[model samples]
Target: MIDPLIVLLIGFSVIGLGILLVAHLFFMDTVQKTRRGMAACAALTLLLVGLQLQHLQHLSSGADLLNSGPYAFMLCAVPAAFYLFSRDVLLPDVPLRLRDLLHLAPVLAAAFLPPNWVAVMSFVVGAGYSVWLARLVYGMRRNVGRFRFEMFFFGLFALIAVGVLALVIALPWTGAPLFYRAYAAAIGVSVALVISVLLIYPQILTDIHEAARLAYANSTLKGVDVEGRLEALNSLMTRDKLYCNENLSLALLAEAMNLSAHQLSELINSRFGVSFPRYIRELRVAEAKAILSRDQRSSALSVGMMCGFGSQSAFYAAFREVTGESPAAFRKKQPTA
Candidate 1:
């Protein structure tokens, strides 16, 4: 980076460290072992921040590998660690050896990267991890209701997907024009900030609505104790008031469930085929149907409104879309039981 950008990057790098730190203290609980990965990310971010700052100050690289060599290349761990963090937090059952190696893979790979290749590896690892997150989150969207942790983590992981995409999309095109690069970087940073706000914040944000979505949408548990786990999680959702919380999101949910957002996302996807949004929608729609089926008082209440749908139009749209039956028509055929 140049002068100002160096400062900006360093500053934001510090901010990223702060974010990782907070996540460490509170968010690393469920997947207790993820602290190592988180630590790796923090260390990388701090190092990158220093490097960026040094670059800004026009300092020449020293002979030490740590100063001029590829040691700085270890920064790839930030994204890689975050990606692995998702895995650890979401899947506590998986043994650490398998997961730990994957989490640490980037660190090991960076050892071979020459200073010139550092940027390439950074992009490769960071962008690859981002893609991994996208695959997991998008793949597991439909299973958001399967677990509180999964749903919550899926939500948070989505932000990482966007951020990683932003960086990948923006950096390659930096050759277009100075203004373009500036605009692209700004957008990427802004989106990252937004994602951090929505996904990685404190627990209060992961509220009742999210829990409800997770509860009813949960169908990933197949013929095992998984259902019991989900049900127990669902009960917690209700008691914890997760459903009503509009700000409730993945990191918060994972934290609440003592899991990482990534691990939660993987569990839902592996167990079910849908992404987080669809999973929660399934719960919402299911609840709407039950309410329509049994409650006479719900007759006047549009199917959409009876459940967790935000608006009558949204409810009707979703109901018809999912069931292939208009809300009014569906209600007409059902006997109030």
Candidate 2:
């Protein structure tokens, strides 16, 4: 019989698949949104599936080692995903390749190991890698400026707490059950959920909570009176098709609004609570959807170029940053009208 948690994992499979499908649908037309975090979520779901399978297979490997293997892969997935999500939500200038390389570390390592060493190596690497992610996340909080990644921090703390529990269970003074390792497996599932919460609908949530607080406090602060320019900004956003420009910015939007860059930026910060680039991405993503829907023969369209991207690479990065799906993958998932 399936355990309660396993039942939930099955449920998660359905939910994750649904999310991935929806994410793909929105992303295909917006060919240039962020999918790094989405990819991480999908990968984590797969990780969970693999773990469930391992449980059913009743493999003779050490429980600790077996449990840890999938987790190690997960360790890479979360941080890389976090990096992608945060970069999209916070910093546009950061390179996607940089974040991507970090996530692939485990797969890279696998090439060097003999088959028998895979289990122990996965456990050791997974446990150690998660610690590295926690430390890195703390550093990101400290260094990445004021718009912090609260989601990654949440997951990091939970993982750290779990690690402490695992250590406690392993202690000679502690009479840990041989089955206690399963407790840690549960943490693996929790980690995925936290990442999902932060990535999906983050812009909407972020807009509601911290935009006001973040607006006036930083060096990037736009200003206090934003409502005055909002109509103009909205007009420009709708009429000018600014999103079609690959390099849209606060200065540009401000220029169009007949306000100084400083004033315009302040207005966006005050009104929208997001930096200009992020605002541009959100708009661009919305536009992508319109274009995709309006044109039935989407194959005739170049998804990346049509979205105001200077290049496919730039569009792909922006798309993943915005919508959490790759262009091709998203298109494949779209429902036929």
Candidate 3:
């Protein structure tokens, strides 16, 4: 009889995969390289889960060794797709070279390995990719504020990667079927976790990509009057209420400050220790707080709009992030005449 725990795990995996497919259809752009790379990662993970399910349930005869080649190939490809996605996000200016193809040489070697050794080879390659990801993440520590919420999701995946490595290391004792079930469960949970984060923070990847550009790329602010430009930016935002324009953007603000978008970005990063978006958000939220205190009867939505938030939801999210309370709650806490 099949183990009930394995059955439960497989069910969770299927639900997570379903959510991922739905998200890819509705949420993903399908054009950007980073999005496409993420889609490939999701598709490959779904395939691995399906294959593991088939093997565990005895859905096919001669499945174990015969299907090993394809499974190992997909296993190796997952990390490759992920690394490409990271590169596209973090270092987009760096052109892809022909030698990058060597990352998949393990798949060719997998065909030569004994069936029992295929899983080991795949895990070894995965460990290397995990280490590479760690290095990339470490290099971005200076921009942690930009990746604050996003880092939690990244750390979750990192922990899952570590768990998979540990599972592979203990394979001699736990055996193949158990390992397959555990791996499937982990992938499923990760897919669901990603979908949930995307639902809540729809702009998570864009924010991270922008942050990575600031972290990994060369400075674009050389020989510039950093102090003078920051003064101008502050005057535009605080004295002139430039942030009150709902259509304001990085390029537009940079133009007003007589700097390039990259220069303005670096200026904010180095001086204010925050991203441009967060800087604008803080200004808007601070204005909203003053408005709320002055007039307690105005609706939060109106206050949000007057302060330049695009919508009520955006205002609430930014306000909570900055102040750790809802607008109404904050207003009520204030001493009203």
Candidate 4:
């Protein structure tokens, strides 16, 4: 028979590693919401792993694990974490407040109660939070787009938690060892799958942050003359060659155009069908190509620097992506004068 404890331990290890990875990436500015959501998920998974270990060691029954204070906290806090994460991703401008901790009050209260009361409290708390989460998700459904996948996952997680709370309530009275183990295994598998997806597609979090910012920017530009603004933006890029400035940024460009960073981002994304960085890269690549064609003697690195690319690697990547060839390859294809 497969050792369920071993599976739990492995799952915990994977989740722990994912937490570390997310923290590292967050520090590196790789993603916005990973710091909060991934940490909470990992912590909750670790708590469940510990409970399973306790059950395996015969130190506590499944009912005992369910009734534990930490377990109660995890039951309540996990959904709250998901909600906070979604809110942060969807509405980054709204800063997190201390009031959000109120969501955990019920489970904290259950921590001091009897086992039966704890089970009942856990079920009640989980059900209420699940409904709240579903409603929140529904409100965001229109704007979520690619982030809808993440929101869906959290919704499913909340629903599963509700079911698990019900199982916890019944497991002690029924003494169903097989069902308890199955639930434990299912939780372990679900945690592992979420962690794996987070690791593999960390960019999803970054995309959500960007999307939220873009949406905010677009909302602000609602009544403005989009055509005039786009013309002004294009003039700033082409006539002034603003893209040639190595330190050019959305904020700087927005200031120049008398607009907000979000507004400028919205203009670029809506009119040009690209993000600010990609828009800048397209300009820089165009300049680099011109330089390459006109000044064949110029070194690739020097040409890259002259065209606002900070590094040869960035220049080459953008060049290849835009032109479908390396700088040198493109240059070689040009006829000698």
Candidate 5:
């Protein structure tokens, strides 16, 4: 028999996570669909925990109660809710259409089917959604940057979703009552980890919102003169020496060129085939090389600072990344006057 204290602790933790997620809906500055999807996920989690607590208490027919139609629907809906949340968070511009509801048809079907069939259907849906979620995360790997921390937490949630489904399906085969308790405990822990991270770094959600908006803009903009924009961007960096600003940012540069940050980011990624940071680093390294060749007496650190590198370490790293040699070594190779 599972300890009553452990069940209570897990139940309260899941309830706390649900409360936090709901609170986030109000606290978030924007009214995005992602918030609603997250709330749905939290509700499902709470329901699942409640069902598990009932089972642990050994109330008459408690296991049967958990296997009932409503419980099966909630079990199946959790992954679907997570998928919806992930889609909204990662691809906000993609409208949720009627076809998306088809993903939940299995849950509805499970409600009418045998209890064993419900478990089978839920596993299939959860496993497929987990793979899809993983692919979405992989695609965003290049652009996520500091947002990868949030991605890691979401990945944990996805893994837990799959593990829970597997444990449910394999429970009959293994005849291991302990696996059910383990599944409930895992869900509680996963929710706690996600909620704690988000509360600590709420900016992650804001960053994701901005990134999704930028991605949407980049995809939809059309009829614009790519060549002209490229020329303007080059002029800003080469002639105006915007790259020489240590505090330069995509948004700042975009504002100077009368473009959106997304537009500028897309231009750099498509035209230069590099991210904004890499483009700036290349420009700074090129300037540093010119200074090194022209003035052999100048220290590498001085040239690095003048060229807009924020630190000597960053200067050397970027220099070596571009030139395959340290700045000091590259300077040494230059001929004396």
Candidate 6:
């Protein structure tokens, strides 16, 4: 009979890989380069885990192939691919130069290294990339609110990466086979955690990417009237209920405020301490609460539409996120005036 733990690990790995591939397909057109590199990393992770699963089930392929030159090389490349993808997202202003390819140098070394040396080198390289990831993520704390929704998950992923790096360092003692199992298990858990976050906030990735771009880009609000712009924004959102427009966007709202998208993003980030998307969502959710309380007869779907949500699910998600209660529950608790 198959070990239940191994079966569970394999299930998680496959599910994670499928979700990553599907997400890549959905996001390919918009964030082409970054998503492509991320997809590549996800594929390599799946390949490594799938091979481990095969060995775990059949026990035909001995530990030899698991620790072989090519397999080790692929294992070593995972961290590099993740690093490059994250670099593109966090430091996109720094164009990739030929020298950036040096990040993959360890992969070549791992390809030809002796079996024992492969594990040691993989540990060293993974550790370095893990540290680099820490620095990159930590450096963005100043603009944390820009991607606030993702910060917790990003931290979770960092913890997972650190755990994997720990596994790499223990490879010799635990043996290659055991290490592979633990690594694959970590990948599965990471995927499940990310998918949960996505289910809650489907717009997370796009919001993070937009915020990261604004976080790193040079300020475009120089010489601009920040106070006046805030006043106008308040008027548009409050008196006019501009957020009620389903088609409202960062660029469109920026135009109304007589500011560029970047300027408006920076203004929102600096003054409101949130991303443009979150700012709009908060306004919409606030309006939603009022409608839910005041207009007892208004259906939840119509109220969501009137409050600017594009879909019923989106409205419920955002409303629950803000109020900690579902729309129906929140409405039920309100006293009829």
In model 4, where do residues sit more than 4 Å from their true spots?
5-21, 24-63, 95-101, 127-131, 147-159, 172-183, 210-218, 222-229, 232-259, 265-337
Tens-digit lDDT track of model 2 for 1-337: 3355554554565455556445543543322234654565455455555544444334234354323555335433444444444444433334566555665565556555543344334445455545654454454342222325554555665565556445544545443333233533454455456447535434333332223323323454345445656776787788887777866655566677778655654566546655555677678767776666556576423755666765655566556776778666666666767
- Give per-candidate clash totals: 31, 16, 0, 0, 0, 0
TM per model? 0.44, 0.42, 0.79, 0.58, 0.60, 0.82
Candidate 2 vs candidate 6: which has greater lDDT?
Answer: 6
List lDDT for all candidates, in order. 0.50, 0.51, 0.72, 0.65, 0.68, 0.72
**Model 2, poorest ten-residue lDDT window?**
208-217
lDDT of 6 by residue, 44-114 (tens): 55655655555455344445644555567666676677677666655555667889788888888776777
Task: Between candidates 3 and 6, name the one with more favorable TM-score.
Answer: 6
Q: What lDDT tens digits, residue by residue, belong to model 3 across residues 1-337? A: 5455556656776776676666655654411344545565566556656555665554334345324666666666666666665666566667778998887687677777765566667767766766776677667767755455655667788788778777776777876666666676677667668767765665455555556778877889889988888789888987999988888878888888888877898899889887777788899999999999999789999999999998898798889888989999999989988
On the 0 to 100 scale, the lDDT of residue 67 in model 6 is 54
- lDDT tens readout by residue for model 4, 149-252: 66767767766676666676776666545434555565665666666655544434554555556655336777778888888988988899999888787678
TM-score-wise, the better of 1 and 6 is 6
lDDT of 6: 0.72
Q: Please, what are the lDDT tens digits per residue for candidate 5 over residues 62-171?
A: 36544556666776676677677667766766777889889778767876887666766777777787787666555655554444665677678777767766776776
Give the TM-score (vs. native) of candidate 4.
0.58
Give the TM-score ranking, best first: 6, 3, 5, 4, 1, 2
TM-score of candidate 5 against the unseen true structure: 0.60
lDDT of candidate 3 at residue 236, scale 0 to 100: 92
Better of 1 and 6 by lDDT: 6
